[model samples]
Target: MDMFRRTFAEVNLDHVAHNFEVLKAAFPNTSFLCPMVKANAYGHGDVAIALCLQQAGARHLGVCLIEEALLLRRGGVTANILVFRGFDREGAEQLLANNLTPVVSTWDQLEALEEMAKTPVKIHLKFNTGMNRLGFSIEEAEKLFDKCWRHPKIQVEGVLTHLFNGEDADELDGDSADQLGKLLRILLVFKPLNPLNHSLNSAGILNALIVREQKNPQHILNQVQWGLRPGLMVYGFNPLKRQDILPLKPVMTLKSVASTYRMLKVGEVVSYGGTWKAKRDSVVAIVPIGYADGYHRILSNKAEVLFNGYKVPVVGTICMDFLMVDVTDAIHGCDLNDLRDKEIILFGKSDQGQFISAEELAHRAQTITWEILTSVGERVPRVYVGDWAKRLGVAN
Candidate 1:
């Protein structure tokens, strides 16, 4: 870790706690939260984030694959883990061994598990309400219910579906609502089992996690279970791309130090491809971070870094290990003397009042905040902050 130099990701776990509270507070107490910790908690480090969220009252955690679940279990996470990507036979056996829930999305998956099981296993049934990405068709769920109605080793404990377009639609108008309707019908069929149900993702939670089912008002299944599984929102991002009413705190701040400075004359180019030419004499700072570190090449000359509370624009094509930022205007009094090792804020708050959020970097990279966060590479060692760091014996 000592060889890491100054470039690394600084994670503020307090923000995660704050974001969790904000998301959970939005819904009723009857609701449950399983903040998605897949993709390394969207690149914020899954094990750490998962543990913090669990401590904050998350009953279960959602991951996309079996490896992710295994990683969590290995990390000593004892809470219920839900694997969204329904597994194959081998994967199902492993999931069962780990006590993780595999969402049965396909009928083949159901039959395979039923055939392979030696003993009973709890499962969550997933229906392809509309996403069509995964899950069983409603007909499949109904038929499966009949088959599993009394089958051993295949207890359907929960029902779930994904909302493909939760961001654009309101409560009762769009595809999300329709998907909810489809899921509701299937749930009604499974009402006798009284399985826990879920359908909301981050966007759905923001707009509508719990909506009253208009028809069949008397049935218990008429209500949508607030099993809102928020992913990006837990990391303080508004997936809808509007004003973040939740105002979630950004948990990770990508940063590095200015290792060296460059003096370029007028008309001189910088970095590879000679993409940026100096209009006048310019001073540049070479930061030890680049596309290889998850700072996309698309940010070549468009990205900005914070220098002592000022914005320094990046110059030329970003290399595998480094990128140069024009510090000409920023190289006032003190920095002119020596630019070596001066703190450069890539995207996050600095001790000197300079601040940049993931949203800014995502914009320049022409990607979403989720990608910006999750794409941070492995080499950039993460420095844990907030109370989590203290409890984990890692805070600096």
Candidate 2:
């Protein structure tokens, strides 16, 4: 056990189930609940998280790349997997053969996909609704829809668009409204072309209240035919800033253990930069996790980890395989007992009942909740626990 490094992340599947239930309750009318599981299911391990989500009644799974879809197919995930990012000609056949849906963003991709062996492939045409990242323009989208509608080998399952300013709570503007309006206009141009028309993400749905109260409601949400595509909310992170108003829970809790402990004199510095100096005879604990392990280097001396039920301040520069925490106050009595190999709560919770929320960690890191979840390194072992875990055949 010592050879394996006492540190590993424990993922709570119960929280994941809770998060799924919350999303289900919020959007009871959703036709397809596609939870994004790309980037190793946001570092929770793709197979494990996808299995857990599938058990929790997730009908569809979303991944960023074709390889991710292939990985899931190989892992026995039979659910309808949608490749959010459309692929090129090289990967289109594999996408079709594996029964994976690609969100076609351009006419060239659609043309490439058309040349594949004549198997009716389900595809979602991504409309460039303000994000300007992917998807087709109004004219291009119309032409592609017409072409695919006429083609015998292609089955257009959905027409989707992403919101650009969904996260912003302030300015209740109509940019999103206009984008949705444009999508509808494109849909109408290609008359009788109705394939699961959807245009909202977690932020879009969460921010629907704003759209309802704004100048135009019909233009933004009323056009959605299929339902919503919620990624973050399904994983238990609130997409809107007004999360206090709506009940949402975080699904993943990243937990690791403390591997070693030491005592440092008053003037001694810690780690690579020697930036952190001990103010007093402090007890320092080293966690076998660092930047190389996905713990951001920005959190060097600014972060805190829960140890022995207490929040201990992290000291010194974060190295590749370890980080130091000032534990003088934490070493008094009960907190100090069995200090060596004691579990360290990195970004989740402690055994003694202390917890660090992902939102808090994201704030400290000056990034988004998505980044925090996706940044979790591969080395950390994921242990799924709860009803969903049991249903997925993962041990507690």
Candidate 3:
């Protein structure tokens, strides 16, 4: 089946629906659910994931760039797509034309958006809420607010900010508090305009207690703004390390099959760099996926894949098209002969109770959940399963 040339990420629409329900259950009062589908829906295939989310009651969609949003529109998704990373003049005009909302980060970009549109453009004014990566500064935010108030063609639909230190609940740094406070201050400046003021991301929503402790608990959530922009949480990964938290099913399961399996003699080296050698006679299975396909080289010798409900240790350096795993002492019920061309669970569950989780791989890679999901390369085909996939008639 040309396994080496083809790797597929099995996306469970049922999991997506479950994740959406979890988010809804957590915050039933939330007005809009902005499921971030940026980075090709975290490499789960943006169009397919968006459809699944939309079918699961997602009213708003979030993307990293203008092109991503345009891709969704081209794919027949007609939801309110929000470009999280604000765009430039041409991009802004394109967004306006397609009825997509651009999160304006600067006064010039906002002005540029204002100039291109014949009709009013809905926008979310992003403030520098400590991430300091995007968004307008406090002074710039005030100026943009004033300008939007004056401009008849620019409608400030929302005001938002991102939290940088959401992972550490106990250490809710002064910077995040200041950023939230700054956003609140900015919101007051434009209160007469009644723009949707929101300052929370996945971490903010998950760590509401931290946010509440710092600022006015009532206003930070229910009372004050329009809604929260939750991305990772909606996708079913816990951003915060809280105790006894609600379980969230991971929406994407990246998997490939074992194309070749062989036994290697002791002292024999495997893969590139000769970093790993067999201590004894070992049965090695080659999985048809690698770094180029987003299996990640960093996971070399540190990751595990599931086969026949058993966890197999990944050995040697991960290659561009394959990686070797030690399957000599696989758990009971594992049949090496039957596993050839059979599905190898790289990061998802199997019928026999084997599953590789994105969170576990992310920890091994020393990165975030977002990076792990987004890094799944384009070559890996996506198989969507569940009601959304059935309704859309998208092939597995």
Query: Which candidate wins on TM-score?
Result: 1
Better of 2 and 3 by lDDT: 3
Candidate 2 ranges beyond 4 A from true positions: 1-3, 169-172, 209-219, 222-226, 334-337
Whole-model Cα lDDT of every candidate shown, in order = 0.81, 0.75, 0.77
Error of 2 at 193 (Å): 2.5
Residue pairs in candidate 2 whose N, alpha carbon or C atoms collide under 3 angstroms: 258-344
Best by lDDT: 1
The TM-score values for the models, in the order shown, are 0.93, 0.92, 0.91
**Tens-place lDDT digits, model 1, residues 144-167:** 889778776789888888888888
Per residue, candidate 3 scores C-alpha lDDT tens digits across 1-396 of: 233444688787777788778777877776556878888887778898888778778888889888999999999888899888767777876887899988888777877886788987788888886787988878775566667786878888888887777554334344555567677788888887887766667776666644444575444342343366777766678777662355677777787777888789999989999989999988888888999988889999999998756788999999998998988887244666666676678887788866677888899999877888888887787887777678777856
Q: Report the backbone clash tally of model 2.
A: 1
Q: By the lDDT metric, which is better: model 1 or model 2?
A: 1
Cα RMSD of all models vs. native, in order, equals 3.1, 2.5, 2.8
Q: How much RMSD separates candidate 2 from the native structure?
A: 2.5
Please estimate how well model 3 matches the true structure, expressed as its whole-model Cα lDDT.
0.77
